[model samples]
Target: MATQAHRTKPALGEREMIVLMALLMSLQAFGIDAMLPALGQIAGEMGADGNDRQFVIGAYFLGAGAGALFPGAFADRYGRRPVLAVSLIAYIALSIACALATDYTMLLAFRLIQGFACAGLSVVPAAIVRDHVGGDRMARLMSLIMMIFLLVPILAPAVGQGILYLAGWRAIFGMMAVMGVLVGVWAWLRLPESLTEENRQDINLFPILRNMGTALTNRGAIGYVVGSALVFGSLFGFLNSSQQLIAETFDQGENFYLIFGGAVVGMVAANFTNSRIVERFGARRVGHAALLALIAISFAQLWSASQPQQPLYQFIILMSLSMASLGFIGANFSSIAMQPFYHIAGSASSAQTALRMSTGAVLGALIGSLYDGSAKPLAVSMLSCALVALAFVLFSERGKLFGRKVPSPD
Candidate 1:
């Protein structure tokens, strides 16, 4: 490890890199959010019911999570830009495949593979950021990226709904393909390789396994990764069930995107605020406070769900507040998790990201599958995940909460 990463800097400034990473990473969010409005229709047309419809979301996550394990090692061997190009290309092709699928099973299959391709987007960007900066500076950059990245959730469902109205849901995949191509072209042209020659690892299986094992067992980083996964499970569970909750349960089919976007608006604000304050306050302190806030909000959500009459406004407010807390938690958690890895950022990022995605996806699918015309399952699962996350944070801190430790990378 070396602190001289500044000497091997890419041509792009911090702002440019942040914007590029946000869009690149937002591809995955766009894939999920833009399809939310069309889930019911897709289900109806495909003649599926219950948990099967949810697999459209779950299967993609499953693939992405499983697939996330390798891209970073590959990026470590080759370079960030080329491996990311492969991911984007796979994404474009699979979006088309998903669009052309004749049945529900076929669609899920394509989405799963598309998710596999998107893993590159998830790992490479974070590795790239670590390539340039470390510690709280890295956390601020990640928070800024997240602030822009979250806009996809706010706008994508609306875009999906519009496509559902104008040309049909298949065109939404077409939109994804076009966006993929555009982003791919932009990245190909402008995004420089951040992995320097000296840090590049050979394509050896033993070291890959060893590095991945280290990533998994690093006590300092493991808790934040796993805890973040649990918190994200709450978000994923919401994604899995939100369409039905909006369209059928609440009788607000037309307002699904508006309501959902409103819920996410707070998160965007939180990310911006975190980006500004994380450096001064420290990632651990800020993230620890947010994790505690999530617990309190989850309790409120649980109470609302337990009532015979679960008010939609209460749900929306709680959703907003909970997600806002996540805005503070996610990036800082990720930055802290990647802090220990310098040269092996790609492998560490890949392993931890895989764990986060796999754990979150499995837990989310379970939560969503329990949907029974009410929000109790979601509320209970959310509180459970939040509490588990807090427990993991406690374990990571070894009973010292809100403590900031910036371990030297080199």
Candidate 2:
């Protein structure tokens, strides 16, 4: 069990800490979203064909998943600062390596390694937040963090495109390395340790493994992790195939970023609203409704896609609705998943995060590979994921659906 010796908040101011965590988490999103505009250029230069281009995104997520299981445990043993510092340095180095790649396979390899480093960014912040708070407050904090974290998606493609025009796609990667340095310096100088000395543990293989097993075996919390994976796989599928579908199927290549950003605005709004309402309505109640809404929106997307000469307006509107539903679902579901564990926060986070990423990455790559110059595949996959996710939710709730079963107090 985790020592709960330093459960009080850190020394950093709440606002500053929130913003810092926001940037740390957003770096991973920026890494993926910022490169969307350049996938075609990379493909053309390196002779990638068919759905092969999507491998660039797939490789990164796969590496992150594979590397995620270690960071949290390491942070628990060695302190968050050392683990985060090493990860940031690695992220900076790998970003440079990616920029220097000369072929498609080489670029994919670098991206895979870079993603490994970025896993620290994903696991540590959530663990750190969990170190101090839990339940609905954690959910509200996560919603705010997500509100800021998600801004990367809204603006990244445009930033990448601007760099692609002004300097080159490779320059976008250079910017990423520079940003990593800036964030690293900020963290090193200002961010105090969230895991205090008393809570630090010795590196023991058995305890670590046991804690991971405990977290993964939780009947209620672990169910949400699987459901979250399935739902997020749909989002990942959209990311993997987004550029191609937006540019080709919709005949909006030139306005790709604008249209994409506009749709993501719905997500931003939903998250902001979720932050306001989740504490009042409870996580499960709100998230379950949003999950159902996502399923409905996906069905509407299928119907829209089947119609001849469907207007881009219709498609974007339906997609925006789906994205909005995801906004409500993400924060609330994660909070519910994390609600059951406090003492094993780091190990639990590590195990669950690794599972979600690995499963989502594989499923997303498969969905992307099914692209055939149309939106049909994406719509079908999303609806299927939603249905499966709902089943997991039902299993988690013991066939119940709505109302909050609050975890025992921290």
lDDT per prediction?
0.90, 0.86
The reply for model 2, stretches above 4 Å from the true place, is 1-8, 405-410
Q: Candidate 2: deviation at residue 224, Å?
A: 0.6
Q: Please report, as a residue range, the 10-residue window in candidate 1 with the lowest summed lDDT.
A: 1-10
lDDT of 2 by residue, 221-255 (tens): 87789998998898899999999999999888778
Candidate with the greatest TM-score versus the true structure? 1
TM-score of each: 0.97, 0.96
Candidate 1 regions with alpha-carbon error over 4 angstroms: 1-7, 405-410
> What does candidate 2 score on TM?
0.96
Residue 37 in candidate 1 has what lDDT?
94
Candidate 2 weakest lDDT stretch, 10 residues: 1-10
